[model samples]
Target: MSDTGRDSSVSSPEALRSSPPVPGMFTMVLHTHLPWLAHHGRWPVGEEWLYQSWATSYLPLMRAFNTLAAEGRENLVTLGMTPVVTAQLDDPYCLTGMHHWLANWELRAREATTRTSGEDTGFAAPEAMRAFGIREREDAARALDDFAVGWRHGGSPLLRRLVDAGTIELLGGPLAHPFQPLLNPRLREFALREGLADANARFAHTPGGIWAPECAYAPGMEHDYAAAGVTHFMVDGPSLHGDTALGRPVTDSGVTAFGRDLQVSYRVWSPKSGYPGHAAYRDFHTYDHVTGLKPARVTGRNVPSQEKAPYDAERADHAVDVHVADFVDVVRRRLISESERIGRPAHVVAAFDTELFGHWWHEGPLWLERVLRALPAAGIRVGTLTDAITDGFVGDAVDLPPGSWGSGKDWQVWSGEQVADLVALNAEVVDTALATVDKALDQAASTGSWAPRDTVADQILRETLLTVSSDWPFMVSKDTAAEYARYRAHLHAHATREIAGALASGRREHAQRLADGWNHADGLFGALDARRLPR
Candidate 1:
């Protein structure tokens, strides 16, 4: 999912399982993802991205989901966590790093309390700053406590608990969150297999579905889904030609493509005016540099950061109230309207990035909690993507055009002119990885003895996979962090070339040494088998 901006387990909703699928069924799908950030840069962009989302979004979202489950809400939402992000979430290194990050957060908040007054400091008033600091410190402490109880051993355990309890219908995905349409058939198959296997390995439960990266799709990709035993995936509304009343079976396959109802989704993410942009909500961008806290409301779109009004909890609360009511109304009205328009009951999916909640829109989780509650009260039925399909929401098949939920609802964002060089770089990397690994396996076969573990080949595949993540081109094209994106693409590509070259030169010792060094950073997918890279 895209932020355009931007959970623990509990009981399965067995209690709510019998609620008949009603018309106007709504599924709120959240795709939780971030590239592998460990050992990468920090500060402006890097591992901090993980920490910020973990503390602000993940923890709060988990609270919301758990609270709902505790209240007996099941089929709450369909969630997709890409394997790349899950790897970091489960890493011991990242768990330790996040603990320290939360500690620093509280320290920063406490330090901000020492300031005496605001005066004309271009920051909030001294009293306001002190209060903000105190509140932040408490938040940090609670977050730290949450981490200790649930995340001490890394996220897999918590996630597994949720899965086993039937709290969520986890979506299967590829290992690195690669944009599958662009990958070669073999690599695409490999990525999907590895991703699903990773899910099974981590949670011991294999998901039948996935939130396709970027909701990106192309014709016949459904075959790959079926081959990998993927039963369902998400696509954009336009991919289904705006008839998102139900999930469509793609091209005679059992794999279902659930189109995100943009009518419902864009309500929160609209570029022009979405709920998050409301003036009364806390602003996402403005900040108090010394305190590392956001103390301003979005007083106005054009308002200078310093001139923005101080964040008033009451004001933000009211905005949340209004927006929650408005969103509920929107979903209810859309469902009623679409059901009427289609002359039948309809299914609507409003999907987004999980970070958009606490990380981008501070009140998002509360707003979400309220909306989910209000929807059922208003007689609007809710279910997961699976529920919709099982409840007979499947519709006519669609020959999905090539598209993504990104900018143009097309592939340009990942393959446009600006990043042509990187695209070529990816092709080079993939082709070389296949050939090198294929050759090594062929030689091993001919010698009548299997190669001793092919560490070099494994590293080559790892670097190659990292090099082609859809994120790099996306960042470069969006100019959000273009330089960092370029540097990373080159970094992984360089690693792959050097190691592959060493292996090709019969210098097994040299290749093994290079692979060892790269493992410190890109080491992931321990079960990865270069032999899986078939012709």
Candidate 2:
């Protein structure tokens, strides 16, 4: 049904009772992604990133889902788990490392307690630090227990259980989360296929939708999506020219492109204003150097980190309640207004990064739980993208222009001047790696023997994918751990070059040695097969 020119105003309660309720829906889409961090680095930057997010975000998120599921709630969210992140979560090395990291967190908390009791220690505030440590210790201990019982085998089983139980609609993305718009067409197609295969292998179910890396797209991506069997994807609100109330079919393809309702999304988290900026919430920037804990709240926008107030759980919880109500009201009004404006039912997609829930905003999971429960009571229907589409929430076809959810709502963040060097580097690495692998595959086919696997070719593809991760350019542009991002990108690029060099020289022994070293260093995608690359 197309929109009719009708007044988009809600009538009074009496008048509303006379008229049928507007058919409206809300879909919460969370993109859960992280670069392959295992076997990369340790403290302050690498594996810690994975473990911290796992314990604080993924674990708590599972608990939230389990809580809702026990109450018989289903399809509460559309969850996107990128293949690279899945690789790490399902890796034996990462599983063991995360367990050890959790244990160490508990020990560190105890050590902080001991240090505070004995002497002044020159720490910022001993009492607050001690309290924070004790709380973190308990949290870590509980998370450890959860991991031992539920995640011992890896995250695949847990996630698969949720899918089977209909707790979430899983969305998968390409390997390494490359910026598909800029990537070579062949590599992009290959990555998408392998990523979908990875998800199917792990969860035993294929995702009908994908959360495009960075919510980015150029023209004709719909054709590729259709080829990959993707039924739907997401783009920024402006991509739909600000009319983001419904999912739009791309060009003439069956694939649907859902534009995120930034009005509702930014209300929860934005640079200028959001629930997380509340004074009572834990400050993400300010940290205790000695204990390595965030003890301060966001006292004020411009307040120095050292001057921020200590975090208060009660205060933060109060803020959560307030924001939850505010957000619910926002969604309610937006849905009604949109429905009335279009003279038809409307669908609103509020999408965000899953890590923002717990890792960035400490109280985000609680907020999510409350919002999910409250929306239904307030007469709003909450569902996944699949449910929305199945219920006929699609709009007219749109020829989407190239854009991302980044600053400027375009590709500047990934392909801007600041990261031009890395862009060139990625292009070179991908081109060389693909050419070398293609040549190797030709030689193998000519020999008519597929007996011994070409491990070097496999490693080359792996390195190429890793080198092109969108995280590197993003980090470089943000200047937050930019050096480490560059180093990692260069490391992968160099490995790809050296390995390809060995293959070109026909030095199987040297190539095998180098491949073995890289395989150990970057070993998340164990099931990745180089032979799958299209010649």
Candidate 3:
């Protein structure tokens, strides 16, 4: 059965009620993240990442989720929010700023609605008013209100509500979205564990599944995930050799791993031909030359942003319906085909950055709303990783090789030329930090003191974390905001160098200054639990 394979006899809600329970299961995973942005940088690119995403993606998606739940429907989606993103969402400063942004957004929508109303006064074509109706303006107002409520609560409450309502399964990831395979083994373990700890503290639920940053995977990571109480994680399709079967626990480890389904995933978004490139979707690359904002259509090739017409919600909604219907159809067909081929139902995992829905693809939330509702109606059940595991449908085990869902689904993002310098610096910092930790442990054991070189230990720990931040390379590669990345890399490198110099020269004051600087930054992992670091 294709995603569109709803029985002709089961066309209505009443008909669906009589239909057999949708046996085909589909899982949607949304990974949400942005590096530490508080007091970090802004504008041209920084905290704006938070505000823009909040306005475009988080707010709308939360609204959609809540809307479904309000209808007494169970929304089965998986959300993977990194700790850094969570921190900013909950930060006092960000909450205040987000509230302001929501107000501004509401005003913008109001202004657009007013402008459209005025422009309609002299309208001649029946299609003109057909295009601009009271319902459309009301929808805009509803979208604004929904966004304001979600943003006002700062997302934490919305997240808690969703989890409590069983609308979605929450997945945890690294504290700051670091690519674990390239990081030091111990740091990798610490990052994953500390991330889980942070999520557990905030959400009041210890996540058993993690969205490994970039979907980057390595053989030994299972050990770390197991240690952190994570029972399963995701990787790219190639990582598990295109096996769409339910995930299999690694040998002798409690952790299970599932590979992404490229077939179904590419339908919604891909390097090319994804829904984002649709002629009707919002244009991401080109901004209005005068306003310095995105206010244009993704008019097909040859049509420039400056020439593109004002956004038309109806056109975009039609596109959303088509794409979402296509997505549901694809999943249904895959489920039926795989079931027949493998003699068992196969799980189709569609995973993507949470930002893609509303940020990159402006109509994404709308599409999500339709697609999620359409899945079950079409005889495909929505599920979480936990549901998949508990149902006993898991298939044969295969070695999941190292891979990430980045460009080429490989390690290029974390280890490419743009990030090579930071990688080298991280290597040096890791070595020195590890040696310092070992010495501290030795000294503490001998002296029976918990306060051996607190200043030095703190600096080393701070430098270690700063060096391992995943921001540098990501910025460099995307060229989205390279200057900030450079500044941050140097900031950490300088701190690490200063701490090392002070440690060498026995200059306690210099070391103290570096530790104080780090303390002020107040990065969540700066004071990582030393016990969590591997021996």
TM-score of each: 0.94, 0.93, 0.86
- Model 2 misplacement above 4 A: 1-22, 112-126, 449-453
The deviation in Å at residue 156 for candidate 3 is 2.6
Per-residue error for 205 in candidate 1, Å, reads 0.9
Q: Candidate 3: TM-score?
A: 0.86
The residue pairs found clashing in candidate 1 are: 3-6, 9-162, 118-126
- Measured with C-alpha atoms, the lDDT of residue 126 in candidate 3 is 27
* Angstrom error at residue 497, model 2: 0.8
Q: What's the C-alpha lDDT at position 414 in model 2? A: 96
Give the alpha carbon lDDT tens digit for every residue of 261-359 in model 3. 889888778755687877776678765332234555577756755466555667777777667666766777778887777777777789888999888
Best by lDDT: 2
**Candidates sorted on lDDT, descending:** 2, 1, 3
Kindly state the number of residue pairs that clash in model 1. Answer: 3
Residue-level lDDT tens digits of model 1 in 430-505: 9988888888878877877665567778888889889999999999999989999998889999999999998888
Instruction: Report the C-alpha lDDT of model 2 over 1-535, residue by residue, as the tens digit.
Output: 0011112352333332244433699999999998888877887789989988887799999989989998999889999999998888888888899899888878877766655555543324677777777777888889889999999888999999999999999999999999999999989998998999999999999999999999999999999999999999999999998899889999999899999998999988887777787778888888666666677878787888867776777777877766776777778788989999998989999999999999998899999998888777667789999998899999889899999998899999999999999999999999999988888888888887662468888899989999999999999998979999999999999999999999888887898899899989868676778888866
Shift of residue 374 alpha carbon in model 3, Å: 0.8
Ranking by TM-score: 1, 2, 3
